[model samples]
Target: MPALASHRKPRSRTRTNSPAVGLTTAAIASVSLLSAQSATADPKPSIDEVQKKVDDLYRQAGSATQEYNRAKESTAKQRRTVDRILDDVAKRTDSLNESRRALGSYAAAQYRTGAVTPTAALLFADSPQAYFEQSQLMDRLTEQQRSTITEFEAEQAAAAKQRAQATKSLESLTASQQSLRTSKQTVQTKLAEARELLSQLTAEEKARLAELERKREEEARRKAEARAKAEAEAEAERQRQEREQQEQSGSGTGAGSDTGSGTGTGTGTAGGAYAAKAEKVLSFARAQIGKPYVWGATGPSSFDCSGLTQAAWKAAGVDLPRTTWDQVKAGQSVATADLLPGDLVFFYDDISHVGIYIGDGKMIHAPKPGANVREESIYYMPIYGSIRPA
Candidate 1:
């Protein structure tokens, strides 16, 4: 019987196109195609491309570091608020307990005097309004007793409200803490990516990258120097024109001499004050050269972009904000051409990086991870704008 069945054409087996089988076949084909495409994918990036990618990663990390700084500041402020709220809540709670104790003593006195039943005294202590609704009990209570009950109710209400506020503030603090953690992670991840990319390069490739960077920086420096020179010449021309006008006016009539002299003196005095502060700011920044670039750090040892600027300005007796975004808004905005020593030079559209301008188109800054605080041309990065913090 087995031999007969084997030879019977396998019962004219039917071929059905099952959906799962079809899907599996299609998926296999798709994977094969993807594999083939990947095999023919682009070759390794060139050194220039690698440099660009690493630079972009560093820029991304800088932005994330700023976010971390902002989140950290917010978290600290929120924590302070929470602590203050908790203290207020604690005091309110203590006051509430004190009022409850007063009510209890009043209830015990009433109970002992036989003026009211124990149950009624308990009700008077628990629910002052309800107990007062009873005219007999209300009439029997002394003014002092009524005052104590009112104060107890007020304290209880205040305590409840404060507890609610504390709860809300705690929730906000938790959220800010989470944001801080996320931002920190983002910065770390970006920096790790940049470091990994750099690690993959050979010594020759690394040297080439460094050379490229140096050339780029040098070109930027040249352009910045030219710009500074041009601005200086224009200023000189403007001053010359003003002097000539003063001389001509004086020659015609000495009437406007005092006013012109006063204006020039006032301008000179203001310029002198700014230059003095700027010298201090630049001196402080120069002293910090070669320090490591540490994100979120505002110290003598290390610093981030904004941190260095903030610390430098602080040395000049100017209080700057912690993050670049805020620091960008801390003072009057100035054109890049008008940037002078001590101006806060913000970079990138989001203003995530900052530096202390030290004149001659150079700025002292804590550049980025794996780098040290140094002076570079303002044109090293795209300038968003400038701020005169003083």
Candidate 2:
């Protein structure tokens, strides 16, 4: 019996140890699989790749900033609309109160004079129409009393309509405020992401990244200069050809010469006027060259891309829309080759960025957060189009 008990204990031990060994083996397999995955995982991104990602994030933030600007502008306009609606409602309410008082006076006069009480008459009558019928209670009232009742009804309707409008406008204002909050959050998130990505880099990596950006900007400048030169040459060639045609057709003489000179003078005058405004815009932009790029600011201190352009144009006596989307539609669409100083040059397919053209294919702009208002080549990003705001 003791041998049997010992054998049973050994068997129990074996059963327990077998499951533990199986679990250990399974755990080891999992560890091995995880190790393989870790070994095959993608390597860390290079500094250049990090820079590209950062740039993309900034661009996304710029888009969100424009959305925030649009929402803010809408909210302001909606607030003004709501104020007007509320004011109208107040006026209507006053008028409604006066109408009610007049009706009450008429009813009291009828009651005192021993005629049918207005409320009693209305209750006994089949409907409001019947109560106001000429053959019914209205027949007992003088013209003034009858008119008062009609006026009261009209005033009541108008007051109700005004109240409805006020309610709708208030709702719209609330919606706009919510939209503004959402847009602001999107901008903040994008900017935070960009900052985090940049913060992850070592100091040496950041320095290298800056050098990479410098080289990229340099290349962009070179391309921009080359494009400007090409466009200028093409324009000159076109003028030369036009002159040759005029000379060959004898259109450069007498009346034709006078007409040509008149046209030239008009063009020169217009050009001079534009040049003056352009100078003002450029001056304003240059003054803001060192200001930090704030997402939604339009100010003496900091600015976003569209804000900078809007402020600069405002300084030049032009009112540009607050967002890049609206500003793009605020002026004459100009070709890239036709871009002149003071033109609002937009960037990105979505038209999220804008800069004041400073000629020579360069633009003064508030580039992005972590940067400042400065001049850079237009070719720094994809060009959407240009607008002659003047």
Candidate 3:
């Protein structure tokens, strides 16, 4: 119980540092109830159930981490692509500038050679003055050519704009990559946490736990087989018993015969396929390994005392009304020593709690707050009785 307290705190009835309670009359009642029903020991579940759930959690986290990494890589590749596009814009802009400069040079050369077509100039010039004037005109023409280059540069200014847009895109992609990387890191952290949690369980306990689990499983299988056989027998016996009772009552020979008919009729299906059905009920109980214990809550989520057992059986296609009291009414009374898997074990005088016994001395139930759903020793609780519902 202390170990259970360490994990999940049972807030309603149990508290931190609380001492073990006394096993009084209420506890005795639970044990007696079980004894009056079946004659078998309650078994604990196999360790395999716990291990498989842990392994699955690790696997899920790992898969999510891998997906995040892939997304990060995709963002990185997009960033590189954006960068390459920006580089292309830069080179194109430089080439355009060079083209403008070359155009200016050609225009200036044409102006200086103005032979009136530059040749006409050579004929018409009468003095060195004329030649000097032409040279001056050539300088003016070079200025016009410069203006033309400026206009061409302005028209092609789109390169700068495109480069700016590309730069923005590159920045965006880089930011996206960073975000994805952060996501990947977060998933890795979760995986680490899960792994650490699993590591806390000792190897020896796991092995012993597994052995217990295997035997328990075998026990369940055999019991199911036996129950099937028993049910057939019980059904036959019930029918025979009922017929005899009917004959006696019809002849008005005995009132005792009427009681027999009622009893036999009610239990006609007893032992018939009860084990398989019980196994299913137990199966559902075990599915809730990590579910946190809650106070007075019976649910698919948080569970309290009888809530866990009732819900577990419900999942297995058995309808158990909520509350321990309601559950106690479902099965045949069996002695505690005769309790086995599929039997309902009760606790407390008020029947505040109950669990489905698998085999051995352990039973699976949502013990209390702070403890995950687990198998506990029958001796751990003030066990009252065992109820076999077939």
Candidate 4:
């Protein structure tokens, strides 16, 4: 009977322990809830902030791409120069060899005759110019022989100068090549970081961000339209005032008047007679409306910013440099008020981007990678300058 009582006491203690274990589990659940709340309290950047960062990354990449383009242009120019110098050197070398052979034969003839010829005496002179001044050889040699000597000396000197230029150009080319590589790597790095940042967002976040971009673009388009309208009206008013003034002065002269026909839709080639070449350039740009943007590509299918402008001007029979830095100097500088359909508009403080003005305060350009060639407001970015390519 005592053993039975001991076993029942153990069962009673087990029931008491079960209640304590349940309370302990409840405490653990409360702690987990508190931890989750704490984590949710931390702040994250807003979508607008993220969008700005991504935009900045893209701008940085664009800047680096321009650097690459500049380096590529430099390298190409240097290579051409080096090739020209090498060709010139080869031709001069052949002429020098021929002259030396002729002189050698003349020396052999004099040796056989037991009388040194003036050609041989001229050879031992301090310098070709000095030989003429000091040697009796000048009086003895035929004019033809003297001319050959003079021509050979000149050719030899030119060859030496060309060789030196080739070496210098080659060195410059190497440096430009290195700079190109560095710029390429920099662009890649910036793009990679931007991609990584974009990858972190959820689909919904991306959609929202895209919506924001759309709204911003819409706003920009509205502003551009307003500006274009204002400019057209202001131009018309000025033209009217000028015509009235000319009538009052009894002068039929039509100076200082805006001659560009209606600020037409960016697609038409109908500006005016003076803008005939510019119209052709704008037509070519309009035809490339939906092509993809590619770095360092200048083609019928794809192009970078400067590449697009260069190609457009080339179509109009005006050859422009391949990079924005050089292309900026390809034509007459124009003020913002004087921008015409064929003007090349530069962007950014560094002038890394270029677009062809297509009237109505709009410009057509290859905006960037992952974007298509299209027309946008000239005010979309800060203007550096404008040049009329035709």
For all predicted structures, in order, the TM-scores are 0.81, 0.79, 0.32, 0.71
Query: Model 3 — TM-score against the truth?
Result: 0.32
lDDT tens digits by residue: candidate 2, 180-229: 99999999998899888888899999899989999999998998788667
Question: What Cα-based lDDT does every candidate model obtain?
Answer: 0.80, 0.80, 0.61, 0.79
Ranking by TM-score: 1, 2, 4, 3
TM value for model 4: 0.71
Going through the candidates in the order shown, the clash numbers are: 0, 0, 42, 0
- Candidate 2: regions farther than 4 A off: 1-34, 37-42, 113-135, 227-270
Local accuracy of candidate 3 as per-residue lDDT tens digits, 308-384: 77676676677765556656888689876566567788875545567777655567877643467887656554567
Off by over 4 Å in 4: 1-45, 112-154, 235-260, 264-273, 329-339
Kindly list the per-residue Cα lDDT of model 4 for residues 109-140, writing each as its tens digit: 43455366656665776656565556444566
Stretches of candidate 3 above 4 Å error? Answer: 1-272
Q: Which model is ahead, 3 or 4, in terms of lDDT?
A: 4
Candidate 1 worst ten-residue window by lDDT: 258-267
Clashing pairs in 4: none
Tens digits of lDDT, candidate 1, 114-186: 6666545555444665655453466677898889878878877888888898899999999999999999999
The most accurate candidate by TM-score is 1
